[model samples]
Structure formats: C-alpha cells, structure tokens
Target: MTEDSAEYLQRKEFYNRMLTVYGRKPVLEVLQDNSLEIHKLHLADSNKPAAILDDMVKLAKKRGIEVCYHDKQALSRISKNSKQDQGVAADVIGKGFQSHQSFLSSNKKHYRILALDGVTNPQNVGMIIRSACASPINAIILPEKGCAKLDPLVIKASTGTLFRAPILRCKTLASCLKAFAESGADIIGLDANAPHTLGEEPLTGAKVFVLGNETEGLSSDVRAICNKHVSIPMLNNVESLNVAVTASLIAFQGAL
Candidate 1:
C-alpha cells in the first residue's frame, strides 16, 4: 500500500469516540482516568484551562494519547447541541458492538435483551443502557432510523455498558421484530392501556421486551406484531412510566 493509504488503514483500527463534556467535573474525571482509551482531545484554544491542560498534558505524555486544540467555532460545529457542549470533547476509542444474535446466544441464557422501538432521546437511550448494564441485561437493540445513534453521551451514560452488551441496529424496527419473533422469542410491548401488567405476564420463556417512544408509545404497526401487550400499573395521578423505566421493570422481572 502507498504511504498515505497505509496511514489511513492504521487509523481505522482505533475506535473513534467523541463526547461534549461541559464544566469542570466530567472533564476532570476523564483527565484523571488512566484506563480511558482517549485518542484525540479537542479543546478551545482561546478558552484554555492552564491547570487542567497541564494535567492532560502530563497524562497524555505518560500514556501517549494525542490531543487536538480547536477554536470555539470548530468545537461548536462538532457538538450538534452547540450551547450545551462544555467546550471539551474527547475521542476515546475501544468499543466494538457485536451482532444481536451473538450477544443473545453467548453464555447460554444468563441474560435478557431489551429492544427499543422508537426511543429518540440520547439521554433516555443512555439511561436505558445504564439500567440494562447495571441490571446486567444481555443486550440492547435499536432500529437504524428514528432511534438515537449509539453516540458518546450514550457511552458515558452507559458507563461503558455499550461495550458490555450487544447492540444490534436494524434499519427497520418492524422487520427486525418480525424476524426476531420467528426466532421464537416472544414479543411483548409496554403500554399503559394494555390489558396485562408487566409482572402479571410470564417472561421467563425466551422473551423480548419492547418499549416505545415516550410520547407515541409503540408504533401501531410494531404493536400489531406483538404476541402480547403488557403494561406497568400506575396509581393515583400517574398515567404512564418513562420508556426506560418501564423497560427496566420488565427486564428485572425476566431476569433468571
């Protein structure tokens, strides 16, 4: 291979990770973490933190991780949610996700899978992953579209659960569920209006718990595919639980 081509090939092996860490707390934490697989760190040149940069310089020196200094404009463009980005970003590589099948079949039934229908919020996605990993769910599934991309916030929120669990991203939620059902996994959806409560249902017999978007619940088409529709019971003024919360309740119930 040509020298430039060889250089490009070498770069591909490193997982490219990025996150907008605003304020001092998260940035300080990341700087202190030696195990973090940071590849490139982008900081605004004008708004420099002399002390923190000093630490980052020392740590990067000891570890040999590269750091990039960028202007505010560049940082803003990279951070989609511009204002919230705390002027710090890091490219920490090292997470590779396996296909859903491998994740499920591995370890022979010690875990459960939580498949999302149309969850859009990265924050919600991260929270669900955190719960899943903490609860130690086997894997997580997200449709390729409409769902949040498995990005940096998610990784940070998951606290590395994104690496631990299998995250399968199918282009279509409906088609994925259809194929999943054919594989003999019972399909269940969470809806406040559903006939059965989550605890009331039998989850131990090869199952997939589906939670939809917060506002829309399950898509009608996806809901139509389910073999069962279960819900969480809410008392008093409560109408429904958040998508992640509902999923955790059902996931824990299904745990062996």
Candidate 2:
C-alpha cells in the first residue's frame, strides 16, 4: 500500500479508540484522573476566564498534554452539545473502546456481548456499562446513533467506569447485529411476550443479548434482525424491568 493510505488507516484506527468528553467539570475530572490517556484539551476562545479553567490549563500543561483553542462554533461541533459543553472538551483515549470489526477479527473461541438498541437514557447507558464492565460479559455493542452520547451524565452514572468499559461502537444497531449474525453469533433479543425465558435455554458460543429502548422497546429494524427472542419472567402483575436492570441480569446470567 502507499504511504498515504497507510497513514490514513493508522489515523482512522487511532480515532476509533477515542471518546470525546465535554462539559467543564467533566473535562476537569477526566484531566484529574492520572490513569486516563488524554489526547488533547480543547477550549473555546470565548470562554470567560475562571479559576476552574485556569486549573484545567495548569493540569493539562503539567501532564504535557496538547491544548487547542477553538471558536465557540468549532468547540460546539467537537463536543456535539453546545449548551452543555461549557466551552471545554477533552479527547480521552478509551483503552477499551474498539470497533466491532476489530473484536470479530480477534477470533475468540467464545464470547458474550450486550447490545443496546435505541437506549437513549444516559443514566441507563452508564449503569449498563458499569454492569457489563464488572461482569463476565466480553463487551458492549453501542450504536453511535439512537443511543445516549458518552457525556458527563453517563460518566457520573458509570462512576468513572466508562473509561474502562469494553465498548464496541457501530453506526447502527441493526447493521451491527446483522454482521454478528453472519459471523456465527446468535442475535438474541429481550421481549415481554417471547415464548422462552432469558435463562431457559443454554447460552453457549458467541452470543449477543440485546436490550431495547426504555419506553418503546426495540426498533422495528433491530427487531427484524434478532433471530431469537427471550423474555425476563415477571412475578405477580409486574410487566417489565428497567433496561439497566435487565442488563445487569444478562451480564451476570452465566455466573448465576
């Protein structure tokens, strides 16, 4: 391959591992963590001088991190949330973040993945990440769209476990599930009216347990992709459990 092509591939791989965190306090907290690998610190030119901003700069400089100043518009584009960005953002190298293609390339003998489909609540997403990180689950399949962005609220909810969670990102849940299904992985979905319960059948080999949206459940496209469906048996008149709680159960399904 040409040198330029090689460099482009390298850059793409590098960015696939990055998670941009915005908001002043969140950026500051990320900077404070010594274990995190920060790529760069971003600041808006219009940011009014504050003690916290000064501290952020000091911390970045102390750690020899590159700092870039951008216009408010550019910074907003970088953070993807203008109102909540607070004129600051930081690029954190997520050591555990990777593309699903990368994970498939590894050719592991057996694995279990928790796939989130249209889960928009940031807290739910965070809690799910925490459970998956703490459990025997190999990774989380998080779609870039139709899901909560990795923001400060999610980081807070995860109790800082977001940085360490094995997150496999995709553009769409349906397409990712299709890819996995084609690769000999069982695409399982959680539903309320499914014929079987969650743990009734043996979950062996490559498996993906999908948790749907909070209010709407799974999207039609994602639902169509699910080859198998199972329900979490409810007691009494209870209809269902929260998505995050369901994720915890699925994460620890093997252990129990």
Candidate 3:
C-alpha cells in the first residue's frame, strides 16, 4: 500500500464516538452499507493482493475512504473480540441516531416496537436487531448502559442489518416501559413462567416485544406493566430457547 493509502484507513476510526465496530467484514459492510463521509479506513495488509483484495482496494478508493494497512496483530488488537479485524476498519459519520421520543407516536394505536430490558450479548442484540428489521417492528429500545452498542461483533453478527434498523435508547428500563404505555403500544412480556401462549393472543395490534436478559429474564418491575404475556411451550426436555429465536418466533408466528 502507498504511504497515502496507509494514512487513509488510520483516520476512519474517528467516526466511532457512540460505537466501536471492528472486524474486516463488519468494517467493510459499514463502509459499503452507508454513503456517509468517513474519516479513514484501516486494513490488515493490502500491499500485496490477489484478485479479490485488489478489487477491494479499488472499492476502498472509490468510496473515498482512506485505506491504511496494518498487520494481523494490529488488526486483532483493534477489534472488539480481537477476532477478525482482517486488516480493515473504518471511522465513519453516523447516518442518524434517534432518541426515545422519536420512537413514539401519539396518534397511532398500532405501532410495533421492541423494548429490551437487560439484553447484554452483542450477538443476541445484533440478531434481535436483524429480526426487528425483518419484522414489522417500528424500532428497538435499548438501555443506554449495560447493553451492546454498534460494536463490530454486533455489526458482523447482524450481517449489516444494523445499518438499516433504528435502535432507540432510554436511561432506564422503567422509563422505556412507561413510554411504551403512554405511546399506546401494547407491551408483550415474553416469559417462561407466563401462562398465556403467544399464539393464544391476537398480536396484530401495535405492540412492543420486551426481550429480557439471558439469566434473569425481565426484571420484576419491568414485567409488571405488561398488558399481555407470552410463553412458548416446552417440548420434551427442552427448557427454553435463545431470546433471539424466541423473539423472532413471536414476531413472525404471533402476527400470523
């Protein structure tokens, strides 16, 4: 890589104020996914390349994202999991970031949304975001803390879906739940202990699917506001499903 190209990718890291997404695929996806101007791009090693890598170099140039070449060790050090930074990273300008108020509407009774009380896993969060983007859900509300952001692991796990979805935020789960009620979206508490099955209820109306943390599920305070509850039947010895699978099941099948 030329000295100028090396300087380019180094600068792309500046776009990550609220997010620090890493990995080659995730970074590339972010670079290709959005047209927003970027500061720079980081690459593992593009000095010597094959057909694919050569083409990738051209694309990087075409997008106006400065390309920097670093070794595998450097790339790994920069990634979230230190897994697959591949020699590529970027600092980009965020397209848009929405607030909690923007997620609500006073005039509508049928507004589909998602409220995640304490989801912590970036992979699960990314999967849920992928599901939400595919479903009719209007937006996903995540706590401002103790939750995943636009981490590279999430961006990779989300398969670039993060670029399309709108994730809202609140300081606390209770405040998010309160806003849900005031906004007129039915809150569906998905609990293993809940008696009602998601299938038994009419889920066509505007609703918010509250996916909880892996171990504790929804907190006592958060579940109290639920207008309805859902539980998938446990067949055989299976106790439960992953929260993303459960949520996706409810989103696609519940509405049918």
Candidate 4:
C-alpha cells in the first residue's frame, strides 16, 4: 500500500477501537483511569480556562497523550451528541469496549449474554454492567443508542465496574438481537406475566436474556422476536423488581 493508504488504514483502525467520552468531569475521569488507554483528548477552542480543564490537560501531558483542540462544532462532531457532549471529548480504548463483529468473531463457545432493550437509566445500566461483569455471562450487548450513554454517571454508579465489564457495542438492541439469533443463540425476554419462571426454565446452550426498559418493559419489536419469555417468581403482591435487580439475579443464576 502507498504511504497515504497506509496512514488512512492506521487511522481507521485507531478509530474502530476507540469510544469517545465527552464532558469535563467525564473526560477528566477517563484521564485519571490508569487502566484505560486514551488515543486522543479533544478540547473545544472556545472553552474558557478552568482549573479542572487545566488539570485534565496536565494529566494528559504527564501521560504523554496527544491533545487536540477543535472548534465547538468540530468537537461536537467528534462526540456525535452536541447537546450532551459539554465541549469536551476523548477517544478511549478501554479493555471493556468491543464491537459486535469483534465479539462474535472472538467468541466461539456457548455462553449467556445480557442484551439491554431501551434501558435509559445510567444507574441501572451501570448496575447491570456490574452484575454481568461479576457473573458467568460472556459479554453485554449494549446498543449504541436508546440506552444510557457510557458517561460519568454510569462509571460512578458501577463503581468503576464499567471500565472492566466486557461489552459488545452495536447500533441498536434490535439489530444486536437479530445478529445473535442468526448466530443460533436463544433470544429470551424477561416478562412479569410470562408463564415460565426463570428458576424453572431449562436454559440450554447459547442464550441471551433481553432486559427491557425500567417502566415500559420490552418494546414491541423486541417482544415479537423473543423465542421465550421468563419471569421471576414473586409474592406479597409485588408487581416486579427493578431491571437492574432482575439482571443481577439472572446473571448470578447463569453463573451457578
């Protein structure tokens, strides 16, 4: 390959392995995380000087990470969500982050996977990730959108478990489930009204437990595609458990 082609390929590979984290404190936290490798740090040129920003820059300099300054619009483009990016972003290559294609290609054994559908709460997302990380599940199939962004709240809520949990990033939950189904994995959705209880179900081979939204439960698109629905047996007129709690139970059970 020509030098220009080689350079383009190198840049593409770097981006493919990176996930951009935006915001002041969040970017700073990523910089503080000794386990993570930062490919680049992005700062908006329009940002006024602040103690935290200066610390971040100092930390980056101490770590020998290259810092890039961009205009506000350009930084937004790097973050992909202008309203929420908060004028700061960093390209991180954490061990926990991986693409669906990469995860699928690397994993060849029968294992349980947690697939989140429309789960928007960062705390719940963080807790679920912690459970998955502590359990026997292979990796979490986290959609790129329609869920909580992997921001500072998630990192804090997870107690930094988010940095170590295995994750397979996808564009959408539906698309990730479709790919899992095509790969011969059983797609099971958790439902309060389902006939089968989770404890009683005979889970076999590769399976993915689809956890739904905090309030609405599963989306229609996800429900229609689920091979089976499993419920947790409860008493005392309790309607349901929190999505994160349910995930923990399922994850630990799978581990057993």
- What's the TM-score of every candidate structure? 0.66, 0.95, 0.67, 0.89
Stretch of 10 with least lDDT, candidate 1: 12-21
Question: Local distance difference test, per candidate?
Answer: 0.67, 0.92, 0.69, 0.85
Model 1 spans > 4 angstroms off: 1-28, 42-50, 68-87, 93-96, 101-111, 120-124, 147-172, 175-179, 233-238, 254-256
Model 1 per-residue lDDT at 30:
61
lDDT (10s digit) by residue, model 4, range 187-221: 99999999899887655678899999999999999
On lDDT, who's better, 2 or 4?
2
- Candidate 4: which stretches are off by over 4 Å? 1-16, 81-86, 202-204, 254-256
Best-to-worst TM-score order: 2, 4, 3, 1
Please give the lDDT score for candidate 3: 0.69
- Candidate 1, residues 98-161, lDDT tens digits: the string is 5454444443532356889889888889888777766755666777677886665765767766
- Please report how far candidate 2 places residue 222 from its true position, in Å: 0.8
List model 3 lDDT by residue over 1-256, tens digit each: 4545745534422232234456545555666664555556766774356554565567779877677777767766655455545555666554433556544534556666677877888899889888877886667777865577567767767776775666665678788788778767788888887898877866567788788888889888888888888888888878779988986776566445
TM-score-wise, the better of 3 and 4 is: 4
What lDDT is obtained when candidate 2 is compared to the true structure?
0.92
* C-alpha RMSD (angstroms) for model 3: 8.3
- Give the better candidate number (1 or 3) by TM-score: 3
